[model samples]
Target: MEYTEELLNEFYNPANVGVIKAASAVGKIVDDENGEIMKIYISVEKNKIVDAKFQTYGCVPSIACSSMATKMMIGLTLEEAAASITASAIVKELGGKLSDTKTRSAEMAEKAVKAAVKNYSKK
Candidate 1:
């Protein structure tokens, strides 16, 4: 079985796949041995996620997972942000069944959100 065209398109053409001009928090996760490097950049206002972006140099599923996670977090409150976001959620949202290797991307997304929250909480 191969990744569907729709899935591949989503991965190739991620929605928020850039860096925020002014980021409130930026997080990086890399497991060299595992070959996962996920970086997320986010901008917030009043503790709400106003803008978000991600840059990842990984497989298609990893990229797609992070990209979709960033898309889902936009316009979410700090509290609401924590409640949502998960690898399973991304997989389900993306029509399900991403390669197991890409699972780290979802964890990266969760960590990124937590990193943003931690940054905001410090202020």
Candidate 2:
């Protein structure tokens, strides 16, 4: 199982790797398939994501997925972010394909974003 440079770069220098003290919303998801969990924090204004971050306990693919997903969310509206983030997108951003396990990384990212959005809507 070879990893791409993009994947390694994201895993090593992950972006948005923390919690927001004053976040507008927070979301979390656990991949029961792999015993991994990802929690997302976001600050939204006028339906746009002003900031995003995530904390995850998982593998390199998970980190890369959340990093890229959070970065993508930073400037997008909630709907747009939800529509675009997916497991396939993660693998594509990494410039490679993934097995089923790696694919779950993207799903985790997607779930995190959706969870945050759902929480935000409650406000």
Candidate 3:
């Protein structure tokens, strides 16, 4: 899939593209259909996310989505991050030009966030 200029920028210069060594929560999700995988690590303190990072193996859009997802979550509380993560929001944050085909990447990003929250809550 051809990515938009904004997505290309994000993919080429991804933010928070590493694992947090001592993450408070970690989440991974895979897209069997496309062989896409995303893993996110987050550090939370006092109910707030102090750090967020991700490793994505997939298309350009997948990397871009995860990059933005991490950037959006870093300073937010766990609850705020969870609520703010959505496909529509991801697309909007990508400058609102992502096509329908790439929405799965955003969905994957959302699933990763929910997984992190669920994992953190289990502790």
Candidate 4:
């Protein structure tokens, strides 16, 4: 699978690759097929995401997607991020798309964001 330079850059030097100890929202997901895991942490203020971070154990695409998703979510309202942060968007931001086998990576990132929003709503 060929990856764009932008995608490779994200994979090599992923941003927001950590945890927020006092995150306002947190979400996690696991890929049963491969045991890959992704966790997202978000801090919200005035209904907007003030910050975001992630920890992922998976392929390059997964790590890149998670990093891109978190960067995209920051500064967005909870509702906006939940509704707008789709797999396609993450792929696009990463410079087009991922291989068929790695498509789930972007999906996982999307799901994680939605899960974080859901967690915040419950609080």
lDDT of 2 by residue, 16-41 (tens): 89999989999999878789999999
Q: How high a TM-score does candidate 4 get? A: 0.97
Best by TM-score: 4
lDDT of 1: 0.76
Models ranked on TM-score? 4, 3, 2, 1
Predicted structure with the largest lDDT when compared to the true one = 4
- Candidate 3 residue-wise lDDT, 1-123, digit = tens: 556777888989999988889799998998998999999999999999999999999988889999999988988999998999887788788877777788889999999998998899999
Candidate-wise lDDT, in order:
0.76, 0.87, 0.89, 0.94
Could you tell me every candidate's TM-score relative to the true structure?
Answer: 0.84, 0.93, 0.95, 0.97
Alpha-carbon runs more than 4 Å astray in model 2: none
Where is the poorest 10-residue window by lDDT in model 4? 94-103
RMSD of each: 2.0, 1.2, 1.1, 0.7
Model 4 alpha-carbon drift over 4 Å, by segment: none
Residue by residue across 20-113, what tens digits does model 1's lDDT show?
A: 7768887677768767787778788887888888888777777877788788888998778767886677777777766665566666767766
The parts of candidate 1 lying over 4 Å away from their true place are 4-6
